[model samples]
Target chain A: MDKNINVLIVDDYRTMLRIIRNLLKQLDFNNVDEATDGQEALAKLRAGNFGLVISDWNMAPMTGLDLLKEVRADARLKNLPFIMITAESKTENVVAAKQAGVSNYIVKPFNAETLKEKIEKVMVHA
Target chain B: MPDGAQAGPDEDRIEAAVRAVLVSMSGDLTAKEAALLAELEALGRTIARAKAEIAQLSVDDITGAHIPSATDELDAIVDHTAQATNEILDACETLEKLEAEVPPAAAEALQGAVTRIYEACSFQDITGQRISKVVSALKAIESRVEAAVANASGRPAPAPAAAAPVAPKTEGQELANGPQLPGGGTSQEEIDRLLASFD
Candidate 1:
């Protein structure tokens, strides 16, 4: 995995964002940015050069699924690696995210090892 | 009244009797119609009054009082847990920085302990999501009450209070309910298996 790639983490919860950032730091990924919701995330994704997107599913105004759909629809961002981290463990959620073209999915309350593993899986093909 | 008609005392008496009966029947019909209309108006008023009472109860007793308080308390829980989790993370970071100064065996133990603490802090996220689900449920109830009131009263749903919580953005959001309670939902391994099938 490229530890130097610019990663954007989108979550409405500040604590979750901080936790993910720290976990990424532990995995040796120093470049990380954050957006609180999908709208802000989309703006950041469009304005900046982001290699990967790590987003939570539920948010106000716009959701991670909404973000994924937007990314997939955009010509420039369609191929960008995306991972969804959410507390929703339903089968439909996973299928919907997969249909939206997410690269990987992680259930919440995950450890650094799980985060590393998912990142490696997605970035290897990126 | 016809061109050829017998003019007799009996014929004139029968005509007068028929006129009297017809007039009485017409009067009865008009009175009955008026009574029915009045009853319908009263029924409408009663329904409107009932709907107004229900709306008041929903807004004043439930949404205005209990629901907001409950949601606020849940929000506070998330806030407090987050604060505590950050403090724990801070301690762990401090321990990490001090690892070099500690003896090697103790340093190894400390590292393992810190890693566990980091993992344990994730409870805050899970609990926070669960509380959010509850808040969402409460909001749904408030919406239903408003809808019922509007339908009964033949008026538009009243706008929620300025301080009232906002609804989720989409149907998918409600479907994407956060983590399930114990004994429910797919396990992580099962989820992974399901994802593998998609491949």
Candidate 2:
């Protein structure tokens, strides 16, 4: 059996985290870990190896943007793929995420197909 | 005059005058009463319609889509109605105050107008209150959705692994402070400059 890919899902909402984890599992990424906010996620990142990061934009204490910035700043995790999920569909927000070096941006109310496509795109470039 | 004798023209003229006065008085009273009844009935219908509309509206509609515009329209309508109602009430009060000064015919006409104004104003007030409640409900729904979204996602999601090991802290140092900044006793100005550099 192929070893499962390690995916870290960061979001403030438990439901969204479960949903993302389920989606990743369907995509054959069975090794998924979750964090409640960016700060905790960063701590976990420092502790373990993760192949990809899926994060929500709006969160308390440390936002997804802050997490992305931190990840990009770290030499070890700089090359790791990152995907941002958010409710805000505005062009400016998308541009900002892209400029911050996000692999892809997914808007909220998305289906499994779209999530899969985004993941594929990020993995291909990575 | 004998008990069975026919009434003379003078007596008939006196009777006609009395009948005319009574008919005019009765007509005025009936018109006033009817106007009041009509106004009350209209007010009741308006309230009922407003209530029905309020019942049909979903909370999501108020908060999720075009909320500000909907609220603004509702506020405007309510304000217009309130102003109209106040004007009508003021007019009614004015009429009452001038009851002795104005001729009965003119006063009765003014009263009818005031009644109509009151009916219109009451309609607006009922509708406005219902819409305001709807707006409040919508706001509540919005907050709930936000909360649900927050709760569904794990508060702190995991991050990608860092490449290097953090330096070990001294026994007396706080573990929570991840890494010590170089030059232990940094000045406040230097700290501010460092923070500003991040921005």
Candidate 3:
């Protein structure tokens, strides 16, 4: 896994985005971008070459699940590594994300170590 | 009194008495029927008036004023928490940068504290998602009240507001419930096991 890979973090909340970005920095991944919602994140993913997507499950207009479906359907973006970082730990949520081809999942209140581990797993498998 | 006609006084008195009883009973029944009709009419009016009052209950107050006010407050709460969380993160980041300059022991301590701060700041995300769920619930209630008001007024419910969040179109979409309350959700270890099953 290249530490310099460009990571895109999607969350409607600013604090979460900042936290994730800071954690990614600690993991020595310096190149990071932020989107407040799934639509904006989708636009960014299409326009730029993001190596990874870390998205929140609950967002308005287009939810993370919706965005994942769109990504999986798209030919170009289907192979991109996607990780769901969300508070939605329901069994169905995990199944839906997995069915949508999410590379990893992280429940909220997670520490930097968890994030690092999940990212490493996905990136390695990607 | 006529030849071959035996008309007795006792028979005549009895027949007269029966006639009087029948007349009295007829009068009482008519009066009771009148009273019953009046009571029914009064009940009908009460029901009609109650419906009118319920219809006149300001739809604007419930669907417009109160619901929005509640959601706005929740939104403000999310905003305030996000702001506070960012402040905490800023402090943590600064502390992290300074850790490298300090001695190894102090640096290790600073790094540990910073990591804890990051973990704690996750409260904002969890709380924000929970607040979003609350806002969605309020909107759902608003829709129900709007429908009830429309029904009371004998009008069709207006189309949902354009700004309303779109309904989930698929079973997968419907499963995206936000953060669950404590003791109500799947644990991370459980999720890991579930994902393993998928493989």
**Which is the leading candidate under lDDT?**
3
- lDDT tens digits, residue span B78-177, model 2: 7776666556555655665675688989876765564444334334423543566677776565655434333323223223357688655322121112
Instruction: Compose the digit string of candidate 3's lDDT tens values, residues B131-176.
Output: 8888989998888777766765677778865787756465445777
- Please state the interface RMSD for every predicted structure, separated by commas: 1.6, 22.4, 1.5
Error of 2 at B156 (Å): 42
In model 1, where do residues sit more than 4 Å from their true spots?
A: B1-63, B103-108, B139-174
lDDT to native, each model: 0.79, 0.60, 0.81
- Tens-digit per-residue lDDT, B1-199, candidate 1: 3322222345335445544554454434577776755554454444445545544454556658888898899999989999998898888788888889999999879877887777788888888888887899998987776566565445677775688776655645655778877766766677778878887
Candidate 2: regions farther than 4 A off: A1-3, B1-199
Worst 10 residues of 1 chain A by lDDT: A107-116
Q: Which 10 successive residues of model 1 chain B have the least lDDT summed?
A: B1-10
**Residue B66 lDDT (model 3):** 98
Q: At residue A74, give the lDDT of candidate 1.
A: 99
Using DockQ as the measure, which candidate wins? Answer: 1
List clashing residue pairs in candidate 1: none
